[model samples]
Target: MFKMADNYSSSKENKEEIDKNLKGNEKKKFEINKYLPYILIILVLVVVIVLFANLSSELNGISNKLNSLSSAKPTTSVTPNSTTENSTILSDPSYNITGSLIVPPKSLPNDPVITANASFGSRLTNINQPLNKSELALFNNANDSYFEEAGQMILNGTFGGYVFGSTVGSNAEVKILDNPFVVNGKPSVIYFGSTTCIFCGENRWAMALALGKFGNFSELYKGYSSFGDHDIPTIYWAPAHYNQSAEDLGNFYSSKYINFISIEDDLPITGGFQLNPMSTIGARINATNNSVYINAFKFILQLNNFQGTPYTIWGKYNVLGADDADFGFKSEPSGNPSIEYKTHNMVFDNISHPNSEFGYLEYAGADLYIAMTCASINNTAPICSLPVIPKLESYEGYN
Candidate 1:
């Protein structure tokens, strides 16, 4: 009976120990359930904060991009080979404003019977006189040899020594057009200018020199630009009674390789620098005209807007303004009609001799114009074989 009581006491102690362990596990489970909702809320807040931060960064990036685009400068968009009908008009305000004028009133008669005169305080004695035998001989003597020498000098890279504040070849204002202006079964060179244009007065020297390389002017005349427009002593390929009539439009230039067409306003400078009305030829030529030369000129003007005087077309290239800026002339107290006349006389005398600075610049400018012509004519001329011609062709994007 003593042994049985000892065994019952040991069993009771074991059951009590088991009950205490179960109560401890139940308390732990209740504590975990009480804080479960708070833990889930913290996790959701962290996810939302992370997502909002990422969205705010993306929005800032987009806003910065938009601001940059809005502040950028606009660029001209042009297609290199676009057809004339579909080509974008590239209008530069600087070019358009250079000696350009609005179309004047049409009330002026087409063939006004106005007398030509040099009444604008010009000092030239022979303002609109035909070249005498001596002057003509001098020009003829200098033509061929000077052109050859200029081309060779350009080829030797020595031409730049005389040029100031400008470069030749690629720096020229010439633009390659989409199609060649052909007339009389040959490529055509056209000039549209005004007698009163100051730039035209300076540019005629280069034009005459370049054209002389290809052909001869039969009836060249000595002329002065408008008295009000600085009375620049110049030569006219046609009989342009400078400061007088506006009817003369034909060029007396003859070339076996190309056709030379000149359309100049024969009128002198009017009051307030107002431009004269268009000449009969300029106003009338259209699609109905049977003359291919006239029609081609009209078409090119339509293709490229007529910007200003001294506008020229050498085969396929268009020069919108004076190719070279005025370099060798003084414009202060020393600049006057008499001085300009003397300077022109000096250039004429030194064309073959080239002993003066003005003579050198004239030839250098002519060399650039010759290079442009060579590019237009596929470098077929004998002068185009010079080393500089090919370089110029590449610079002009011809090759």
Candidate 2:
């Protein structure tokens, strides 16, 4: 009986201890609940601080860029002495200045009279329509397959509807007219592209920037009456690669394309051709040497090696701003393709020698346009006011 009583007393003591432990745990849980809001707030504050630091760095880079741009030299620079000296030189025998060199409106026509109404604007319409239901399903499945193989890429992005291996500029060569042409003692640019090329349109912008160095090439998209419907896009760049959006690219090029004389995809200047301009620019294979496999021909094919809205052209020119990486990068991209041209100097005579089908009268007209672009830009006064696509001056025969 005494032993039983001692056991009972021990059990009571154990119960008391268990009750005390349960109360202590309850108190701890309550205390934790009380401070959870504050702890969560502190975590949020830390995230904000990190984001702010990143934002501040981005702002600093922008500030530096703006400062530099504000300090950039105007496209045209002429000191009083430099102008005076140039005038004196022109009067001398060595520098036979063309009449277009004279400044002011007297030397050339006011603008190009756009006669060809085949505009890029028509392309703007129905450009972004999504595919049919079956097509969309197929596209998604294909894109998922690509990701499963390795990783996701732009080839399987939203814009392209997840079509694997397909790209924005899916073309190879831009054939010129089967005829001879000339520019700065070289061939004209028109001899190199068709109306369908995005690169031809893009190259014109570069040609404009470079020519802006010399003369006042008229702003055409809005200024001219002819390129009324031209709204074709360059390679559709992603938001990462450009400050502007895809809509902005469509709108900007629609409103901003300086309509000189550009061929319409439907209108072949000479031989039959099928190609995208941006692709052609990236590839750097003009029409004259479409069939030739000479070293020079192979050289240009290799030089235009990088892809996706290439920032440079003409061997050493930069189309994008100077801040682009020298080699190239994949940080921000749209339709990135690799291009490599190996040739040094682009000699037209070598590529489009007489007897070549691409060397013809139409080629001469295209050449004239190229010459006009360079002459107008490099000219001190700028006189290329001809229509974007020059007309048949005369198709009389005598080959």
What TM-score goes with each of the models?
Answer: 0.60, 0.21
Residues 1-399, candidate 1: write the lDDT tens digits: 778788888778878887877887788888889989998999899989998988766764565445334423232322223344333333320010011111222122432323344343454445445666666655443445565565555556664544321222333345555555555456777787877776777777778777776676655666656667676667766556444555445566676666776767666544212345544545544322335434544554354445577788777777767765443545435555332545446656765577655565566666667776777677777767766556655654554
Error of 1 at 358 (Å): 2.0
> Candidate 1 — worst ten consecutive residues by lDDT sum?
93-102
Each prediction's whole-model lDDT (CA) = 0.57, 0.26
Top lDDT prediction, candidate number: 1
Please list the residue runs of candidate 1 whose C-alpha ends up more than 4 Å from where it truly belongs after superposition: 1-121, 137-172, 243-247, 269-274, 277-281, 284-290, 330-344, 396-398
On TM-score, the candidate that comes out on top is: 1
Question: Which TM-score value belongs to model 2?
Answer: 0.21
Superposed by TM-score, candidate 2 places the C-alpha of residue 322 at a distance from the truth, in angstroms, of: 9.7
Worst 10 residues of 2 by lDDT: 237-246
- Candidate 2, 1-399: lDDT as tens digits: 899999999999999999999999999999999999999999999999998988866775565455334433222221222344333211101111111111112111222222343423332221222223332222112221221211112212321221111111212111111211221222222112223333433333223332232222322231100122122232111111111111111111111112111222222212222334444433432332221212222322333322223222221111221111110112324332111110101112312232322112112222222233333234222222222212211111110
